[model samples]
Target: MRNPLDENKLEGHLRSVAAAGCQITLQDLEGYRPQTQPSTTSLEYESQYKLLVQRLVRSFSLEQLTQVLELYHLQPPPKPTKRKCARSIVEQEWNWPSLADVRRKKIDSEFSSQTFPLARHVSFLLLGKDGSQLRQLSLRHNVHVSFSDRPLSLKAEGLSGSLRLLEQDVKDFMAGITQETFALPVKRTISLASIQHISRTSGAFLETVDSQKLRIFYNKSHPHTLVLAKELIMQGLCQVTNLYI
Candidate 1:
């Protein structure tokens, strides 16, 4: 007998089940079953199955979506956009109830949490100017990291092993950063050029500010190189000042 539920009704029911955190079953998609008549091709059944899975996957949160992908041992794209990740998950041959059971067990049994106190500058660096680094770290570690601005800390939750590795990565990153700001005189073209040269030669990052100042971030281990860069900027500024006199 043909199931009474259409694709739209089945999708609505699945969305409610997901929101309610209920395990999904093939029975829940009774409406999506192929008709009993001879006109329904096997290819039609396959297409309907894929379409239902795609819609179901979209209802999951990004975190849950990733967990589902991981549960199936599916590799997401390098960029891991939500649409791409969902498409990858939909391609997997999943027994929904079994997959959900394994995902729940894995999360409950192996997960741990940690918080790191971050210096303002360290947080700034880890988050990147655009927050791309933080996103990358979250995906790479398979961990969720939340940052607090007032207290300036990061709270991370993931599998215990991944959490340990993420902690080490954060520490190693913090150890390497050395940030300094330089104030420039009104006529700073010469000083800016000198600073740029120092940045390229020493492999430092520079953040220019309103033509009046700049900030440089480099490894703290290279104190001597930083001293030389500062001297070069000052010397260039002095030369420019003398020329205008």
Candidate 2:
């Protein structure tokens, strides 16, 4: 016997079930057995199926929709687009808190260079004291103290190399010291000829040099070593562009 119901009629049945709030399950539908009419084309069957789905959606409540979607493992509809807020638009326009601004804020801390005094850019090293093995003196220029195996080494990392003298020199200077402290004045004046000679010999371009102030830090009352350092300064052995104690 030929099946009498077509795809359209089956769609109508589905709409009626949904409108009456009559719940239907997959098992019930499978048992009911939808029958296509003998005259129904393949395209017509597909169209009717789509219409059935659309009508069912329009008639079902939120709860029914949720249950149906869950039963079928279907994805929910996409969320609606959100409207732009005034503050967000303003922030986009201003573009504050840039990378540089953030970095500056972070670096501008209590221990920043601006808060601390300016020190000379020099190397720091730890070596032995006693002034023995003078070759061990080859250290980073910024080192003021000795950190070595020698127990006699003084902790003078805070002092400058200009203030340091050889052990023999210190001994000789100490012999004549009656006062507590001694000061040696160095002349700031440098002749143009001397500058040219230094530039040629040391391969230092004088034109790019900024400040040339001679600075010396040494032990107080060490007159012998002080005079020796002063003579070296006079002879242009080392150029103190900027000296800081």
Top-scoring candidate (TM-score): 1
Candidate 1 per-residue C-alpha lDDT over 180-241 given as tens digits, one digit per residue, 9 for 90 to 100 = 88787556564455655666554555567657777777667656656765776777778878
For model 2 the TM-score comes to 0.21
Q: lDDT tens digits, residues 1-245, model 2? A: 32446544655675577677777665533333333321122335444443433444544444455454445555444441111111111113222223333444444322311011111111111111233323344343233334332433333332322223333333443343332121224535555676444433332223212244533333343344445534544566335445522
How much lDDT does each candidate structure score? 0.65, 0.36
Clashing pairs in 2: 123-142, 144-156, 144-157, 145-156, 145-157, 163-217, 163-218, 182-221
What TM-score does each of the candidates earn?
Answer: 0.35, 0.21
Q: What ranges in model 2 sit over 4 Å off?
A: 1-4, 28-55, 58-62, 79-245
Cα lDDT of candidate 1 equals 0.65
Q: Poorest 10 consecutive residues of model 2 by lDDT?
A: 119-128
Looking at candidate 2, what is the lDDT of residue 127? 14
Error of 1 at 232 (Å): 18
Q: After superposition, how far is residue 167 of candidate 1 from its true place, in Å?
A: 0.4
